[model samples]
Target: MTIERFILFSITAISLASLFYIPKEKYRQALVSFLIFQAFTWPGTILLVQFGKIEFPVREFTQATQVGFTTNYLFYPMIFVWFVIMYPSKACLTKRFLHYFIFVSFSVWFINFTTIYTALENPLAGTLFSQTTRSYITFFAYYYISHGFIVWFSKKSNLSIGG
Candidate 1:
């Protein structure tokens, strides 16, 4: 298989396996995260592609679009659940800030790197800066929104993050 296919399939498998570990109560947050992630990523990617911000080599009737959507199906829920579960509630501000910084920084870089290596040859038409900016924005938005929803839902439902 091509590296693209391998990466996608590996993420798919790992994602499926990860689901088994999620507490039943937390499924709601995962679902919400997945939906919101799609809400952002699907259209955002299409606009980027159409506007020449990015390109996918695949050209079979929106298969390229499917790449964006499907890969997200794997990653977003896992990330949402993980962040909620690992939230350091009692940590000092410095530690919490470092956690957010590390995850966001790494996530942005890995996500952009993966996009360039697997889905696109490169960001297109002088869109490297724009695409990079958009990526950081989207990912940070995802992180905050995902975490916020989990916190909110947990409060409303009278549940803990893992319970």
Candidate 2:
């Protein structure tokens, strides 16, 4: 298979395997986080694509949607599951900020690398700095919103955050 296809398959496999790492007690949190994150990702991806801010040239569901199904619907939500499950809720503000920064940076880099390998052009910005800046903003927004929702849901459902 081609490298792009191989990379996609590797990501899917890794994400699936990661799900098994979640503790049994946290299964409910994982499920809720995954679904709630998808609620944001689905429309967010569509808008990005629809507005010409991004493109997924090599992706599943090409006939059905412009978004990358694996990334938006599966990979990202899975990552968010871990993000919520492993959040440093009681950590110092600096540590918490670091946690967010680490995840955001990794996410932006992942998308940039994948898009470069799988597409003919950069999807978001012209220069590397500009691309990284835009990606950071986009991903930080998604992370912030989804994290907030997860926190709110946990409280409403009587689930312990980061337990």
Candidate 3:
């Protein structure tokens, strides 16, 4: 496999493996969050790609392939699952704001940088710093809204596995 594919595959593997470590009782909650996040992000991604804002290349910076679909559909959702789980249960407003800022900023930077480093380019590729910064802001908005829903849903119900 090409290096790009290899990297995507490796990440997917690691993400999948990480899922096994979450506590069994918490798995259902995490899974619910994962699915809910995917429900929104998946279609949001499609719209971005369709609008020429985001691009997903295959082995190279040419055609795209669904082979690495798990990178988004699986890997990200899994990561967010853990992110929600790790959130401070009793955090104050400032702490929560700081945590979300740091987490979202780093996450967005990592994703955008990795995409470019891996030869993928988005519509804002010309202004590297600005593009990434804007994307970070935009993604964090989505993250907050979706993650908030997950948190709310989890707390509002006693829904767990087999419930």
Candidate 4:
């Protein structure tokens, strides 16, 4: 297997192990967010290497010294949305998460397209990463929205998998 795949598989295994360490019921509230963080960051990074477009030749830029961002940087924090949705308590955590989600996501997108992530770009993926400080926030918004779905799904499914 490629180095990227090996690294990704390792991360996935570790994340699953984390899940095992926590109690399903208690963790369910924050499960989606945590899982998303793991899923998108490392695994997503691998996928970007595997399937997402890259600018430099794989071998030469092993360090991606010439490139700006690795694939996982932008996708990492999206778990916030999931945090919002899957927040199992009767408390208003979901509402708070939504507010933060909207704020953080917009901020990341605005910053990115505007200039924040300008320096963070990979030479190879000049525009492929499409990340700016603002883009990071947008990704968070995605996480919040996804968490909403996870919450909705778990409830609808009537399964305690997500608590």
Residue-level lDDT tens digits of model 3 in 1-163: 7666777778778887888889888888888878987876677677767766667665332345422366557766776787778787698989877777776776576677666677443453446777777767766776788788876876665578797
TM-scores, one per candidate:
0.72, 0.88, 0.80, 0.38
By lDDT, the candidates rank as 2, 3, 1, 4
For lDDT, the strongest prediction is 2
Off by over 4 Å in 3: 59-68, 120-126, 156-163
Q: What's the candidate order when arranged by decreasing TM-score?
A: 2, 3, 1, 4
Q: What are the runs in model 4 whose C-alpha is more than 4 Å off?
A: 1-26, 51-103, 106-123, 127-130, 133-141, 153-163
Question: Cα lDDT of all candidates, in order?
Answer: 0.65, 0.81, 0.70, 0.46
Count clashes in each candidate, considering only residues at least 3 apart in sequence or on different chains.
0, 0, 0, 22
Error of 4 at 66 (Å): 14
| Top-TM-score candidate index | 2
| Pairs with backbone N, CA or C atoms under 3 Å apart (clashes), candidate 2 | none
Cα lDDT tens digits for candidate 2, 65-96: 77778877888888888888889999999998
Q: Among all windows of ten consecutive residues in candidate 3, which has the lowest summed lDDT?
A: 59-68
**lDDT digits (tens) for residues 1-163 of candidate 1:** 7877677677678778888887888677667766665666666667776877666664224633534544554565565556666679699999876776666666567667775666623566655567668767777786777667656766755567997
The predictions' CA RMSDs to the true structure, in order, are 4.9, 4.2, 4.1, 9.0
Of the pair 3 and 4, which is ahead by lDDT?
3
Query: What is the alpha-carbon RMSD of candidate 2 to the true structure?
Result: 4.2
